[model samples]
Target chain A: MDAKITARQVYKRYPSVDGGEITALEDFSLDVADGEFVCIVGPSGCGKSTFLRILAGLDTASAGSVTITPGADPRKPLNNVVFQEYAIFPWKTVLDNVAFGLEMRGVGKAEREATAREWIERVGLTKFAGYYPHQISGGMKQRVSIARALANDPEVLLMDEPLGALDAQTRKVLQQEFMRIWEETRKTVVYITHSIDEAVLLGDRVILMTAHPGRTKAVFAVDIPRPRSVESTALPAFSDLTYRIWQELEGEVVRAMGEEGQIKIEE
Target chain B: MTRNTLLIALTLIAWNLLFFIAGWWQPLWWLGLGVGFALFIWLADEAGKTAPLRYQRTYEVGLAVAFPVLLLLAWELIARNEILNPRWFPPPTRIAAALWDLTIHYDTFNKTSMFGRPWLFPQTLAAEGWPAAWSLFTESHVLTTLWRVFAGFIIGVIPGIFVGMIMGMNRTVRTMLDGVMSAIYVLPKIAIFPIMMLVFANPFGEGPKIAVVAISAFFLVAINTMAGVRDIDPVYIQAGRNYGANRLQLFRHVILPGALPVIFAGLRLALGTALIVIVAIEFVRARKGVGFVTFYYWEVLVTEKMYAGLFVVMALGVLLTFSLQWLERRIMPWR
Candidate 1:
């Protein structure tokens, strides 16, 4: 299987308040194949978002190099990102927000709007086309953000906890919609989240990460069939994967929580 | 039928009794005339109300019309009767008459120094006759004053915004200039007028009045603009960068838009400053301008002319403010 993204060892260091350094990530490596959906889940501040941001070329890795295999035209969309904070432009209408990427790519107004309307409707935001970001709910804003990323038709879509801000019910509904959208678009996606259930539901493979000098602890193949529903989560296979990943993550999480001689892990 | 009607009747009786006792009118006839006038006013207010509410409509309408009318009458009685000296407070009727004559002679008055000098000031016969618009137009002093205000505002605001934006964006620039600017901003810009006069004294000096107006207005605009630019949010700048926006694009899209509300605020302050400085500058030894006309009237004791000059200044100020408010609404429709 051809890998879409290959990362050798990566190390990232950031400055602390005391003029010393804090290591965010160390000796991190992962491989993702074309058409694959990968989800990364860990405890809080595990540098998952940092990994995704680096993949999106928003930040540079201190040591390792990340490379993407050439596939689609580079001029089209190479990598698109949806930030965690519902990063829709407040000044733009929902339609304009969705159409932003196409507009940036120099698409004509008519063509951009035409294409944007399709995705806007797909995200169930056609009714909100004329509304500004502040007028919409958090879920709807995230939908507009997702539509914006999709409008670019990128080869790789990096999502940094795009659904983390929504209410639980809305999150579930949007997750279901996201699967349908993924099936329709078939874009390679790398999703970062702190939720174990979200990782199991969305990813073909789930990469478990440790905190404080974050590193990939293990990669588990979901091996679950596609066209999956939230109901699929009730199955034994889903529970087994969740339990196994949790089992592996528990040790690293303990180590991560420990300082000096004390090692305490919260349930 | 309503409490308002009763109240109005009572008010009319009271006013009529005052008029009768003061010997301005006969009690019976004036009382009847007052009642009729009150009824007419009440009807005008209640006609639009579906229920014909008595007290509410009459009270609202009565306040609106009667307050100003009463104030004017008091002013006229006080000023014309010398209760308040005409030099200090001209009668409203006399002001109205002067305004009418000014309107009639506006053309000639603008071109000629119709109100400027005692000899140039028209005699009773000429003053009574309507003058040509050419005189008003020929009065270049108003033009000169206006030109100075416009020039000062432009010279002050352009550099102010440019510098303010620079200091606002760069921490180093901000730190370097913030203290200096604070000191300069508070220093009375008008105090420099004497110095300017000494420097530009009588060699093509064109009088230091214009320079004085320019300087005072400049510091006001500059201080406000710096505050405007410095107050822009960093998130806006970061957002622009995330979208692949260059420095220029960041300024054009985010910084400019963010700074606009504050800049308009500065402009408003600067406009007022320009007006004040222009008047103050022209107060000292200037030969022309509304300020000069006002001082000239006061010196020769033409109290009516001075009041007229003041009225003109007030009218110009109101008109300018209204226009700027309209433009502000048009540009920032979202706001």
Candidate 2:
């Protein structure tokens, strides 16, 4: 598999209010292959979102470089993001929000509308295409967000805990929907999440990171069979893999919580 | 009868007896009237409390209508009986009659009419072309006020939004202008009318009046637009940029829409301020506006006509508000 995204020793630092520098990411490197679905799971403030933002070209690394190797089509956007908040414009209808990326790229109105309608239909939101963001449920809004990212036909998708805001049942349903969509498109995606189960279920490879100046802890290859579903999570192999990843992440999570004063460690 | 109804009936009888039969037109009689009214209101409140949920809305509407009708009746009675100085505080009927007179009476000396006799618009159009028909509107005080508001509102809001956007996007610009803008925002716009008059070449022309109105609107809109732009969620801007939107596209797709709701709020405020500033300006100088007519009527002790002018001002406010709401709905369909 050819590598489509490469981040070499990325570092991010922010000036604290007290005049000292706080590191967000330190010596962070990631390589995502073509047609790969990679999930980066970490504790809160682990800088996984920061890394995704850097890849999306929304922010720059303080040190080092992150690059996306352009595909054959120059017209296609390099990457599109699925924000955690769903970030859909309240002033736009569902169809318009879905078509926003194409519109921004100067696509003709007719072509963009057609494409947006097609995606809306795919998301089963055809009936709601004319509805504003405020008129929709959170799960439905997130679907629109996903459809928007896909409709742009970008080379890569960067998702920042897209399903994190949803209830458990909605999250599971969307995870299945997302898996099905990824199976169809095979677009390279870098998904960030705190949910270990989500990382195990969605990604071809799950990368775990340590907190406080986030760095890679472990990378686990999910050798599970293709065309996985929610039923796969009931299987012994799936549970064992999830358990192993959790075992690797548990110490990092506890340490992070302790540092944040959310938890106390005994000796 | 129910206890509440009985109490209300007794209160009404007591109110009339205290005024007519007792011939007690002193401070004590007035106190008795107040107590009687309070008792009636208490009975009404009790009735409202006991009303069924489905009938609650009917009760509210009844209260709304009854209070205003009762107040108008009291005013008519008080003015007719000379309880208050009728010359200064004319009854609602007199104000309505005065308004009717203003509508029909065309002043030959001033060459102006209240509505330019809009009833004659069809006849004017038939006798003359569009220009002649347009003259009917131009020769009215109402039209003058409307023109100033519309012109000043447009002139102020457009550049106000532009400069506000600049202030919102650039941190340094925002820092530089924040203090100055804040200081000016709270200053009463009417206080600067004298300066505006001095600045214009014609002190008594439309220039100073419109400038005062425009300046009032500009500050309100600029401040509101700045807050609106700054208040937009940063994630939307990030999404726009992430999707390969350049500066203009980001503004069109993200910033403008995000700021629209707040901008509309500002527009509404600016509109109200514009009306106030124009009226104040007219009061101070202009010879051909609703405010001018109102002040003129007050000067001549024509209380009814003065009240009519107040009525016109209120009507203008309602009309302008409705027009703005219509425009806002058209522009922001998603809202």
Candidate 3:
């Protein structure tokens, strides 16, 4: 299979203040086919987010190679990220924030704004096009952030817990939106989340990663039928899939906690 | 009006009326003013607790307007009663009269006037070339200080922001400048006037005074702008880079706008410091500015003119600050 995104033996290490190297990711590897949505779930500090950053070119892997196959249009951006926080510029209006990538790439004003308006409309933020980030609610701001990434039309979308900061209600709405958008566009996505349910619902294959010196533990093909919404969480197959993934994740989460001294180790 | 609102208004009026009839007497005057102020605040706070959005703004403006009026009346009462020697104190009315006098007549001996009668500008310009017209404008006290302030402010702030942006983005540059900037920023700007005079060819001319003011504004703006730029949220910069922004695009779209509100705060501070420095410089060694006008009138013992001169300075500072705030709102409507 020709993969759209590739990461091989991706290793990341940081110099700890204690004068030793702390490995964030060790032997981390993944290959995602074109138009595939891959979700990786792990405890915090597992370096799942680190791997996404490497793939997005925001961070570097110390040892391995990662590349995204560029689209036919040379000018199309390689990748765009939706960060954990609503990283949209506070000073820009919703329309301007969405148009920012095109503007930076030297697109003409009328054309960029038109494209931004369409994306804003698609995200249901048409009424807030002229409003600043401060004027909008957190949910609306995240919508703007998502629209901003989507408007650029990158070859791959890297979401590092994009819905992590939202409330449960808003998260559900955005998760459904994400599934609908993915179904429509089928763009390559590397989604990092702490929620197994989210991974089972959104990804073509769910990749579970072990914590601290993070490495891939298992990959589960979703195989569940589409046209899925939050309603799919009620299905036995979805629940079974989520439970099985969580079973693998449970040991890692505990080990992560014991390492942090939040939960004591008896042995 | 609600009882609290009416009571707040009535308390303000009653204080004014009581002082108007009773006049200001030392212990009683200070005590009454203090007691009345506290009572008025209580009423205003009581009014605010239930006031609708529309009426809250009215109370705010009312409180603002009343406090200064009361201060003016206190000044009048204190001077009229000979409590503070009116010759030096000069009640507000006498100061107003002195201001009017300065406005109407040019003081040929001092070579100064409030505005040099701008109504004659067309006639003057027709009869005279640039030099003559320029000389005529420089004779006005208000215009003289204003020109020096504007010139020094523009000269200082432009380079200040440019250098500040440089220092902000470069760690080495910032570290190199930080210590010296901190030292100079606190030193009294008026103390530098003598050195600035030695540097200029014409010590007594406009050069040294404008230079001193410019220097004061420079350090203030440079340091403040550097802080403003350095303090910008880092995530925005990351977002800019991730969006395919080049260096110039990142600077334009992220760094500058992110630093703007703090930069404007720096501007407001620099403007205040600039005015204070120029006025002090004029007081020591000049003949055509508001500070010089105030000092000259004091030398001749026309105390009211001195107070008028001071009034003009206060008005200039307030007017400049308000103008800066308006410009800020225009530039950063996002705020």
Q: Per-residue CA lDDT of candidate 3, range B19-49, in tens?
A: 6677645647677767777876777688777
Model 3 clash pairs are none
What is the C-alpha lDDT profile of model 2 across B44-141, one tens digit per residue?
A: 78778878899999999999889877777767767776778889999989999999999899888877788888888998999997998998898799
Over all chains combined, what TM-score does candidate 1 have? 0.72
Give the residue spans of candidate 2 off by over 4 A.
A262-267, B1-70, B125-135
Q: How would the candidate models be sorted by DockQ, starting from the highest? A: 3, 2, 1
Rank by TM-score (best first): 3, 2, 1
Among these predictions, the greatest lDDT belongs to: 2
Taking all chains together, each candidate's TM-score versus the true structure is 0.72, 0.91, 0.95
lDDT of 2 at A130: 94
Give the 10-residue window scoring lowest on summed lDDT in candidate 3 chain B: B23-32
- Tens digits of per-residue lDDT for model 3 on A1-267? 689898889999999776989899999888999888899999988999889878877788899899899889989999999988978998889999999999998899999999999989988899999999999999998999988999999999999899999999999999998788778887889999988988888888999999878999999999888878998889999999998998888999999988988533432
lDDT of 1 by residue, A227-250 (tens): 888998998999999999888888
How accurate locally is residue B38 in candidate 3, as Cα lDDT from 0 to 100?
Answer: 81
> In lDDT terms, how accurate is model 1?
0.75
